[model samples]
Target: MARAGAVNYLFGTRFYKMAYVEFGNPAAPAVVCVHGLTRNGRDFDALAEALSDRFHVICPDLPGRGKSDWLQDGLAYQPPTYVVALAHLLAQLNKPVSWVGTSLGGICGMMIAAAQNTPIKKLVLNDIGPYIPSASLQRIRDYMLEAPERFGSMADLTQHLREVHAPFGLLSDAEWAHLARFSARQVLDPTGSGKRIAMHYDPKIIDPMRAAVPLDVDMWPVWEMIHAPRLVIRGAESDLLLCETYERMLKEGAEGYVVADAGHAPALMDYESQARIKAFLLEG
Candidate 1:
């Protein structure tokens, strides 16, 4: 297990630092795992640890999430800005990488993999696809907008996460604990009396989502442009990635895996999920 490290870079004159964790030998094949919207790289801890024996796994905290710096402009949270920031991170790695992404992270990977001369060698989209239904988008947006800003204690916050992320599947108590531990930070109470626990990510990240709630997200052209062999993981009960879209992805030459008893997204923390991802990434 490698300790966390920070990568410093500039995005249009704004200096920012992105935090990341690494695992396995530096010389080993690189695998970059990105988290979903409102999630940080720590979400991949279990998966990264499991793959450390054979692959160098890098999980990065995108801007406004985890230990990374928050963008001054909320609008900068879009995919284009993420691509630029991730490009810098990839440049620092200086190696071809397999990408494992969840939701927002998957969208980023799709865009990068579709680009000319991209460094991505293979792509794994976890419970996300090229097309996002309007209903799903609205559901996510509503949840973010209504999320609590403060919690009286870690236990309270943990309970909140359990409810909000129940769609992540049947996580064990330990798994839920891990999510709670890394998903929040202490912040001064609004009353200016003491401190309270708050969600780890910047709330401003929802700004762009509020500004534009598109009828649906269509990225099929981007998906069509990608040449890298890919795998799509979907939660059997996911409202976000419909069965129709998953089937279409398979028809378009992508391998597919479905996790039962999960919704919206499957947490790749379990042994079976980790094994499936490792096998796909190791393929020739």
Candidate 2:
């Protein structure tokens, strides 16, 4: 079973709420899973359930996404804001936690893990690494900017997700359906129409990203500072985390796993993917 909850925190002078889902007993070892840009905590449903028996798995929707409150200033959507908010979340949990982050979430994890006395005990970066090519950043920015504002129906939304997230690897119809169900929400159409489906996140969240694109994202210094045991998961076909980068990560002492036939990311919805992640996190 999963329980949904929210935490209210002050980001500058404004207060925002971040929503999250929890699985398993709170007394168990904590594992925090964070999603990519344009994705929410629910994306971890299958993975969290798989690990629930042995871990207290927590998946949080970063501010401006899912059930979390959108920031008044779109610029607040950067990694710094997320670091502060997530730090607050960790404080509330009051435990050292293993971290599993995907894409942009992985970047946040890296920043936090690099900090002095971070609570992260183990780190798993999914489909992302310390260095991101400028081309990949530009590609992601274009995709987000060109996304549709509304969909006529859930099927339409599902189709769109399938096309854009083709890199999520091979997911079953049921799995795709699960993604669609949680990826959107019903809202009154702007034209005084009945109702329409909209992406769960705030569109303005892309503001800072638009400003940062076309430039490589470099974080090797941060990566070097992290002393926690690390695991890097990359899609074999992913342009975001190149093979050379993956090899370099391995040489730098981080364990690596490549998900074949996937592109930007490998959704850990499959049994094998979940098992690999589980085994790593459980390692002594």
Give candidates' CA RMSD values in order. Answer: 1.2, 1.1
lDDT of each: 0.91, 0.92
Where does the lowest 10-residue lDDT sum fall in candidate 2?
186-195
Could you tell me how far off, in angstroms, the CA of residue 174 lies in candidate 2 after the best superposition? 0.8
- If scored against the real structure, what TM-score would every candidate get? 0.97, 0.97
lDDT of 2 by residue, 1-284 (tens): 88999888889997889999999999999999999999999999999999999999999999999999999999879889998889889989989999999998899999999999899999999999989999998888898999998888899899999999999999999999999998998888878654399999988989998766478878889899999999999998999998988899999999988888898989989888899999999999
State the lDDT at 229 in candidate 1: 97
lDDT of 1 at 233: 97
Shift in Å, residue 214, candidate 1: 3.6
